[model samples]
Target: MTILAIGAAGIAAVLLAVWLKGVRAEYAVYLVMAAEILFMLSAAGRLEVILDAMERMRGYIRVDSAYLGTLLKMIGITYVAEFASGICRDAGYGALGNQIQILGKLSVLGVSMPVFLALFETLERFMK
Candidate 1:
C-alpha cells in the first residue's frame, strides 16, 4: 500500500478502537493486533533497504565481519524486544513488558561481550 493508504488505514483503525472502547472494550484487542500486523507488513517491505545499505557500506569499511554481525544482531534483538514489549503493554501486562526490556538489555550485552573481550585481548598484546 502507498503511504497515504497506510496512514488512512491506521487512522481508521484508531477511530474504530476508540469507538469500541466505549462499547465492548475488550474487543479492541483486535485493533491492536491489526495495527501490529500492518506495521510488521510495512516493516517487511523496508527490510531490504536496511540490508542493501549495510552491504553497500561494507566496501568502504575495514571492520571485522564478526563485529558487524554482532552489531546487527543486537539491533535486531532490540527492535524485536521493543515490539513485543509494546504488545504486552497494550495487553495490560506491564510487568511482563518490563521483564522483556530487561532481557533485551542483557541479550545485547551478551551479544557484544565477545567483541569486547577480543578488543581487550588485542590491546593486551599490543602493550606487551
Candidate 2:
C-alpha cells in the first residue's frame, strides 16, 4: 500500500505542478507513462499480496467454491483490461487501446472457458 500511496501522491504532485505551470493536459500524459512504469515494476510483488488478500477473503466469508474462482477471474480480467487500456490511452493510441481491449476480452474468455464448461456440466448433471 505504501507504493500505491506514493504513486498516487506523485501523480497528484505532477498534476498540481502542471496546473500551476499552465501545462496542457497532453503534457500530463508523461506522468501517466511514469505511473504505468511504476506499476509494471511493482506489479509482480503486489500480485502476491493481492492473491493473499483474496485467499483471506474467501476463507473469512466461506464463499462457495463455484463462485470464488469466477469472481477471482472476473477481478483479474477487469484489472488487466483496465491497465492495458489505460496505458494505451495514455500513449495516445486509441486504435491500439481498442485492440488491447479486444485482446483482453478474448484472452479472458479463453481463460474462463474451462470454468464455464465445468459449470455447464454441473448444471447438466443437476438437471438429470
Candidate 3:
C-alpha cells in the first residue's frame, strides 16, 4: 500500500532527522519536506486514476455534468486547502494556515451557489 510505504519511509526519515538534528538541522527539515511531497504526489496519482475511471463512465450515464464538475471542484478545494494549510503549519505560519482554511470554506460555498439557486428556482416554479 502507498500509505504503508510512506509510513515506513517516514519512520526511517524521522530517525535520520533525529540523528542529523545536532549536525544539520536544515537538511533534516528539507528531507522531511521531500518525503511529504513524495507522499502527496502518490496520493494525487491515485486520485487521478479514480477520477479517470469516473470520467469513463460519463459516456454510459445521463448525468448532469455541471454538477459533477462542481462536485469535483469542491473536492479539489478541500484537498488543496488541507495541503496549503499543512505547508503553512509546517513552515510555522499559523495565521496563514487559518486563512487558507477560511478561503477553502468560501470556495466551497461559491461552487455550491449554482446548485442552491437551481433548488430555489425549482421550488418557486412548483409553488406557482
Candidate 4:
C-alpha cells in the first residue's frame, strides 16, 4: 500500500480506537492490535522488493553474503522487538516493553559480533 493509504488507515484506526476507548476500553486495545496486524501484513508484502534491492546492492558492492544476511536479521529483530514493545506499552505493560527493547538491542549486538570480530582482526593486521 502507498504511504498515503497507510497513513489514512492508521489515522482512522486511532480515531476509532479513541472512540471505542470511551465505551469499552478492552475493545479499544483489541482494535489497536488488529490495526497493527493489518499494517504489518501490508508491510510484509513489500519485503520482497526490499530484499531484491538489497541483493542488487550486494552484487555491486562485493560484501560478504553472510554479513548481508546478518544485517537483514538485525533489522528484522529490531522491527519485531519494537512492534512487540509498542503493543506491550499500549496494553499498559511499560516494563515489559522496556525489557523487550533491551533484549532487541542485545540480540542485534550478538548478531553483529562476527562483523565486529572481522573489523578488529583487520585493524590488528594493519597494526602489525
Predicted structure with the largest TM-score when compared to the true one:
4
Worst 10 residues of 4 by lDDT: 35-44
Cα deviation at 104, candidate 1, in Å, is 1.1
Tens-place lDDT digits, model 3, residues 71-118: 789988998898888777766688999999999999999999998898
TM-score of structure candidate 2: 0.62
Per-prediction CA RMSD (Å): 2.3, 4.7, 2.5, 1.0
Least accurate 10 contiguous residues by lDDT in model 3: 85-94
Whole-model alpha-carbon lDDT for candidate 4: 0.93
1-128 per-residue lDDT for model 1 (tens digits): 77788888888877898899899788786797679777877877887787777777787897787777887899889988888888898778989999999999999999999999999999999999
Quote the lDDT for 89 in model 4.
88
RMSD of 3: 2.5
TM-score of candidate 1 against the unseen true structure: 0.83
Over the full model, what C-alpha lDDT does candidate 2 score relative to the true structure? 0.74
Name the weakest run of 10 consecutive residues (lDDT summed) in model 1: 50-59
Off-target runs (Cα >4 Å) in candidate 1 are: 1-11, 125-128
| Poorly placed runs, candidate 4 (over 4 Å) | none
lDDT of 4 by residue, 21-83 (tens): 999999999999898888888987888988998899998989899988998999899989999
Cα distance off (Å), candidate 4, residue 57: 1.8
TM-score of each: 0.83, 0.62, 0.78, 0.95
Q: Please give the distance, in angstroms, between residue 70's alpha carbon in candidate 1 and its true position after superposition.
A: 1.1
lDDT of 4 at 69: 93
